[model samples]
Target: MSPSAVLHRQLHQAPTLALSGEGSYITLEDGRRILDATGGAAVSCLGHSNAEVRQAMIDQINQLSYCHTAYFSTKPFEELASLLIESTGEKMSKVYIVSSGSEAMEAAMKLSRQFYLEKANPEPQRTKFIARKQSYHGITIGSLSMGGHKFRRELFEPILLPNVSHVSPCNPYRNRKDGESNEEYIARLADELDAEFQRLGPETVCAFVAEPVVGAAMGCVPSVPGYFKAMKAICEKYGALFILDEVMSGMGRCGTLHAWEQEDVVPDMQTIGKGLGGGYAPIAGLLIGDKVIKTLEESTGSFRHGHTYQGHPVSCAAALAVQRVIQEENLVENVRAMGVLFEEELRKRLSDHPHVGDIRGKGLFWGIELVRDKTTKEPFDPNLQLAFKIQDKGLEAKYSISLYCGQGTADGIAGDHILLAPPYNTTREEIVRIVEVLQAVLEDVFGELKV
Candidate 1:
């Protein structure tokens, strides 16, 4: 590979060139295969180079590549929308397609704002949004404004939106009292949210947005039982929207196609991506529940929003095909069954490790939080960047595996964790190999640190 002009994530260092991908492995320019355990930030749910997704894109391109969405609607997107809505059993009455998770979240924010205006009563006073601390929505301006990640927000704090506020995340490992029962913990969190809503003057709040299984900041942490229901109750009491951001956890990554499906409450709006097009195309969407849809249908009859590639035909076709393959092959079922085995293997192998603090998540979305003292649940010093170090170690050919890393797991700035979200179609053999590589990589990284 020659010196390049591409502006990569790290300006000073060039990343290894991935020459090809098959199944769960990516072959670099030097021909070393690295296991894609994190699925490239949990995007490649169907893994890389899936033939069906490729052919779908090709067919759509040959027929229709680009059409102004304002002027026309595309078949692939229409069908994809129907497919998604049907997956929700029509609880989500419509789907708004977008190019990425950030776009979906941006749309969600806008839609929530519009929904209030379009309602029968039209409460224009609803201007505030509340999200949990240690949560990540997206990186774009509107989405970033709504996110609660301190480090990601600090640099742009002055310019970020001031209407959004943060609350404690539903993380028992860190937040719950030592003697707190799950029921008591959930009750306390619910009261806290209710208090926040009251403090904001319930009528002034538009929505309460959160991840069903938190990503990035909290590293794959799922809410406790009845947490969503309790939170949604607060939203309902306050007549505000309940939004779930599933960009990293939905579309079968968490056993079911929708992570909210397991939470026993339907969100007013839900954002999904990463797995939607399975990395074959850049795509994500917002699923609008009947409440919002009916509001728009009766008052405005149209969402006051538009994007040039609102429903890119090729992207939709690619996503449609990927989703069909998932359905046809019963891969979501595979996720449930294999998820049990994966969890078992991880706990069996790593449970006794001294530094491993907590194993948390649902289905294939799991996080291993690292701590300096397991007994005190104290995170390692942020300067060590332990999670990032483990990620780098896995990328080395000797270990030969990929792992997603995150910091600020304990707070919005302190803990470290590694995320494991392998493709849903992963085989038992591949799962075993992934764990083995992970164990080796962790050992190597820790051994070098001499901790």
Candidate 2:
């Protein structure tokens, strides 16, 4: 490969180039086909190419592509926003479309603050946010401040906003006692959140932000039963808004249109992305619930934020088309049925494996945590880069599989897990291929390590 001007995620070398995609695989420039079990960070839901989404983008371009959202509202944006709101059965009264998950989260944070500011009697002191440790919301400055990932935040800690605090994530695998019931664990977590709110002055807290299913930071770790309901009760008691970051876990990736639907708790504000556009376009949005919408309506009747491409027409058209496909083909049902099989097969195959510590997730999102010792649940040293190594090795001709890998699963800087988030429309044969190839990749990696 020749040296390139494009700044890649890894500064040392350019990664493999993908020439094209179809179904659950991407064709590389080297004439190799890699099964896309990872969905490129859980973004490609309708797979890499879909005719409807492509046509929609082209149609929108033919009609109109760019119009400052501040000046005008486009049909695709309006229709997409309405579709999203109605998908929640109007539980969310409005949607503010943006270009990416980070922007959606940034909008949610500001909207959270604005929700309080637009109240009958503005409470200017309610400026703090409470998130969870071992969580990631996004990568922008504000979103980064709200996130609790230790490694991602370390370098920017000094300059990041100081108003966000964190509580223990509701991770039963690492935090729950051997015999603790779900109720006990939830009570303990709720108490911890309440304490944090009290420590910060409950009235001064704007919102409590969390992911319905924890994403990259912890690798698809869903909360224990009733965890979200209990946490939301605490936020409501203190008159604080509740925000759910479902950028990676929502949009039917977890077998529901919204991950929070399974949790039985509707957030005051919600951020969604990743699977929303299904890699058809860059699109994400903030869903505003009735409480916040009413408050803002009665006060200023406007959100105090704007982006250059807040409601990009082409992106909206692609997302709208992608969602229609998900709904039209009943793909969410497929995700549910296929996810059960995927989980059972994974557990059956890896439960007894020495290095496979935990298998957790829901719907189509699942993660396998690799450990140094299954008995002690000790993670391999971060320096080993075990998860990333497994990812790179999966690209070899023998495996030709791609896995979504993550580090810091146990704590802020330890543990490793690789996630599988294949397309919602994935079939059994593809899933079997993914699992068997993953097994082969693991065998190859451990064999190479001579462990």
Candidate 3:
């Protein structure tokens, strides 16, 4: 391969160019069609070539594509916000749209701080935040600082914000003690969080940030029952906001419009992306609770933050169309039904594999952890790159399927797992095929390892 002008993730190797995508498959320049099992990091919930979404974009472009939010707002932007708020049952009173999850998180952080400032008795000292270990928020500096993924944050540790702290994530597969009941484990984690707040001076903390279902960093690890409720109780005790980062697990990805809906705890603020626009357009947003909205309304009457593409009409149009399609087609219902099938198939096919350790997730999102010692739950050495190898092998001719792989689930540096988040509209046949290909890939890769 010749040197390329465009800088890619791997400078040494040029990735295969995708020619086009239809339904659940993407055609590459080499004329090979690969099953899109992961939806490009769980963004393409509607699959590729969605006619309705495409037409919505075209319609918006023909009318008006861009407008500065400071000067004016377009119909698409307003309508999208209204739809999102309605979906939340008006719990989230307003929305601040941005171009990506990172931006949405950045805004959430800023807004939290502003909310404190707008309080009748301002909390200038409340500048600290607490997030969980092995959680991913976003890639930008501010959001990255809020994230606790060890591998992703190591290089930037020296420059990261000093006010953020991390506690244990609700990963029962790894952290729960042997013979401990779920209730006991949750209580322990909640104690740890309470201790962290006291150590940081409870009055000095602004918010506790976390993903409802821990995404990439820990590979679809859902908290044990009552985990979020416990955490939220602690946050409320300390008078800090609870911010749920649902970029990967929300918007019906986990069989509900909001992942927090199942958790039974409403966040003071929430950030969502990925499935929001279904990869048709770049869009994400911070949803503000009524309390925060009222505080800001009574005080400054303006948020201190703004982005150039905060409410781009085209992105909003795409997102609005995606939301409508999901509702009209009852795709969330499909996700729940298919999710059951997906879990059953994965358990039936891969549960007995020697390297398979844990299988957990909700809705259409699932993760299979690969371990060196299943009994001890010892993760494969990071140097082995087992997850990447399986992913690459799956894309080979024999398998021809794409999988989302991640490392550092065990201790933020050593574990490997594959995440499967198929499109919401996936059929039974597609679910079966995905499992078949995944099992084949695991066998081939593990066979090479002589396991």
Model 3 Cα lDDT, one tens digit per residue, 253-355: 9999999999999999999999999999999998989999999999989999898989999999999999999999999999999999999999999999988
Candidate 1 clash pair list: none
Per-prediction TM-score: 0.98, 0.99, 0.99
Q: RMSD for each model, in Å, please?
A: 1.2, 1.0, 0.7
Give, for candidate 1, the lowest lDDT window spanning 10 residues. 1-10
In order of TM-score, best first, we have: 3, 2, 1
Please give the lDDT score at residue 281 for candidate 2: 86
Q: lDDT (CA) for every model shown? A: 0.91, 0.92, 0.94
Candidate 1, residue 24: CA error in Å? Answer: 0.4
Report the Cα lDDT for candidate 1: 0.91
Q: Which candidate, 1 or 3, would have the higher TM-score against the true structure?
A: 3
Clashes of each: 0, 0, 0
Off by over 4 Å in 1: 1-3
* Better lDDT candidate (2, 3): 3
